[model samples]
Target: MNFNGPLETSALRQVEICDSKLTDQLRLNAIERSRMMDSPNEEVFDRLAFLAAKFLQVPLTIVSIVGDKKQFFKAAHGLPSPYDVSREIPIEDSICRYTLQNEPIIADDATKHELLKHHPTIGPWGIGAFIAIPMLTHDGQVLGAFCAVDTKAKPWTEDDILMLKELTASVMREIHLREKISELEDESQLRDKFVAAISHDLRNPLNVAKMGAQLLSDMDGDEEERADISRVICENVDRADKMIQDLLTASRLKAGDKMPLEVTFGDLSALLHSTVESLQKGHRRAFHFESEKTIDGHWDFDRVRRVVENFSGNAVKYGDESKPIRISVEDHPESARISVHNYGPSIPSDEIDNLFNLFKRAQSARDSKHLGWGVGLTVARSLAEEMGGRIEVESTEEKGTIFSLHLPKVKPSLH
Candidate 1:
């Protein structure tokens, strides 16, 4: 959305038309990659747009992504339509076009500004003052601008531009994060297909390794050394097989494949405690599991166990070893709540939203002594959602980090 505001300046009176810039084509190309054309308002963008309007104390504000000839409003505040209705305007009528080509702009009186004076929006839209900051991509593409508008002439302070620039930066980061996630999801889908194809080819080789190890165990030999070697070989084979299976499942989930869960009625409490006990045997720290009684649920027992391992493993690896990792299973009327809480540094607010993003880790996690690819939560969340439930996360300096998951207690019967 294009905007005009009460804040005016003499700086843009004789400014060159935005079209005079040769980089318009490259800028348009990058804007196209954002996929914002004719898109509806997003909450993230809307918040910043409103913040820009209120902070500038202007009558209008907009977050626009400019394309070849269209200005698409990802969000807007105080904008009345056909501009709002269409959520786009011709680039010719968009003052934001200049902000893309050059530096951020200000026009104290649009009626006297050279290139903008005779523009189509001035008289009808009542453009008296305007200001904008460029929305830049990481690779240095100017996508568009976060702009404010007024219908009456006024002067704006340097602080106004600074605040708007900050808001634009915030909005651009969100936009870039969104684009990154989308790109990763698409890449994951392609990778999943490739994994599925290769998994089939590798299955026979894995079977041979397992069978060979088993044969060695059965053959006549010095029992002690032979048995130990056999056991090591079998263990490694099993581990490799499990890795393949996990990769197959993750790929399928990322590719939006439905899980063929072998659901059964079972006790979630028993499952959690048993898994923790097994892990505690090998893990360096203590695990405290709390459950008053059995909480029965119809779930994929294997999948639930996997989720527990992922959460518990992360806690053991990253959490303070001196503190016990806490896991609790509680029953809700229609669901079972399973939570894993670990004592550690709080996850930053900026990184929380990306916590479950595929192949992404909290910056703190990356900076810590622990290492991970950050796909566990994404997989866990998908499994929870597939089972007609959801996962939630909370972190605080005092309380540490907790991953809470609720799953439906009843599974719908399938034919």
Candidate 2:
């Protein structure tokens, strides 16, 4: 049952071979990866195994690490159980071990290989031809073996082996990426929990402060003192309310349980005008509204309004408050587009793909003083998609950034 290291070759022969051909490091690394897969959240590993099986069009695919006494299945796609065999067979009987020792991939005709001619599992399971490729990490450690098994003795083409190897490489990369994402999700959840606990504890004191400020203002005293105390309480209350709203929005968006949309025909011009006027009150930024060709569409008025407000608020907070924020409405026969442009540093190319993910914000936005919980665009995107519309963002260093919302136009009924 002991699977010893690769057989010792002559010193001169070993010295002549390239370092990349060495199998000792790869085998040990695969053992380490197999142990890591024993932890919770191994679904990512399992998914990769399944993809490998599908890509190779094989009935069985396994991510296995061969130990001294057993071959452990870290991830198995076709097999029903995680541990298939009770103990490891002889090293000469291990196809994967031989595959790793002799190049990256190995395939043998079951009928031809003397070592596998009498294998119990191969004959009993009707397995004829098999292939195994080493799964290597970026550091040149073999994490495990990516293997595919078939029941028929069909000859495998060179292309088949090449494709399987490519798939194994992709699976290795995916496993590494999934690990990183899991770490980030854990960190984000911890931060969210801390914020929630702090907000909950502050709520009681905030309510008490509001009540006390109201009572003091009602008492006969200097008018200036009463006004100032009332203003202080109001400002604090508004800040608390904003924080609560942001948290609620993030939660609802994540849960996918926000209010149902009630779509109706609406004039974009009037909506933009009213939204701008309301957002401008008490705000120092100048607002410029423009329309090209009368813009009209059938949309959820309230939801669309919320999207507009979110964009405007973001512009006011991130863009220069001294300059004007421009809102443009463009109408076409089939669709109407609303764009909010703000002057600010351009967003990074990498973050654009993930900008709509829950709680994901661009790096440029992270340091902004007026930042929210990073849920505005996420919610806006979900709402827009539900209403059969699309949202896009474009940014440039010189021209600044623009967020565009496009919705379908309402057509007259033929009936």
Candidate 3:
């Protein structure tokens, strides 16, 4: 069924009328968090609806949440016809939407009530007496209604109001519990991913080290071959150690502790050059450094190196390996910029914000051949911020991807 646009609320003489698209969207979000839409009727909610109907002396009681397009009857006591079977109705047909302004609606007779006389739930569906208490969130967003309805017009008493209100509170409590449980399940799933990703990343280096050791033992007396094998073993072991160190740094940063740093006067251009040379020795990928002049800043040398290395390592893992990765340094009046650019698929716009978050990875990175625990970027961002710098990224299909670290020329006070 076609659901039309916004339905204007009939102004109530006593209650202030306030409704907007933003408020509606927030209500929808709160409903989503409630996690009640499209769910099969639970015994607890059904019992609550039944209690409301029984106590109020009404034939129908519903715990309904109104969505943008439809109204979902999460729990229904005496709903009739296709609505009872389908458990939902078009948004235009929902009487519960009228109560979304956080106002308790009490209509002794919908046909006589000015606000609801023309409403479809009353006009065509023949709902007479109705009372709905809004299920309001802590932040003031209205999820929908816990309502009772009768076929005959009947005045609601104070006791009926009190009972419905109490049952509505119970419904909200159940919703809050569901929201907490959903959050916990999400956290548990993330933890599982963290463990699996860490195990896969750690196993790679260990296997490399083990194979290198076996090769060294098998090689009979070629000194050059022995030196190369020994270097490989040390590099893999160091790689594993670096991963562990990054993980520790990420944890500390997450705990709101400032990253420990030793600030010293250093040239960013020279640092990038040396970092590139070191990275080149380790991998077959070509890394090019570009700088017109030295850009000096008061920064932690090791921290800067580590951040740049992390960016470049990610470039190798996610970028097109056939093309050379470009590292550029720029000196501005107030700040210096060092950027690592790679020619590859652009990062999706939606994933950019969480790219540096611990245990979060971009879709591109996750799909790549590299197996990372998603901690390197997090540590890099923390180190950059600790050194009075911030990392910026620009990625597009036309220009490729650039991860730039911008640092102030003057050292920032740690205190």
339-399 per-residue lDDT for model 1 (tens digits) = 9999978888768878887666788878886545556677877777767778888889899
Tens digits of per-residue lDDT, candidate 2, 53-134, equal 7776878887766543345566677774323433233433455544343345444576454434444455654667787787
The clash count of every prediction, one per candidate, is 9, 3, 0
lDDT (Cα atoms) of all candidates against the true structure: 0.75, 0.66, 0.83
The candidate, 1 or 2, that scores higher on TM-score is 2
> Which scores better on TM-score, 2 or 3?
3
- The per-prediction CA RMSD against the true structure, in angstroms, equals 14.2, 12.5, 5.1
lDDT of 3: 0.83
> Sort by lDDT, best first: what order?
3, 1, 2
In model 1, where do residues sit more than 4 Å from their true spots? 1-242, 413-415
Looking at model 3, residue 121 earns an lDDT score of 58
List the candidate 3 regions with Cα displacement exceeding 4 Å. 1-34, 47-61, 95-118, 125-173, 211-223, 251-259, 330-337, 354-358, 382-393, 406-415
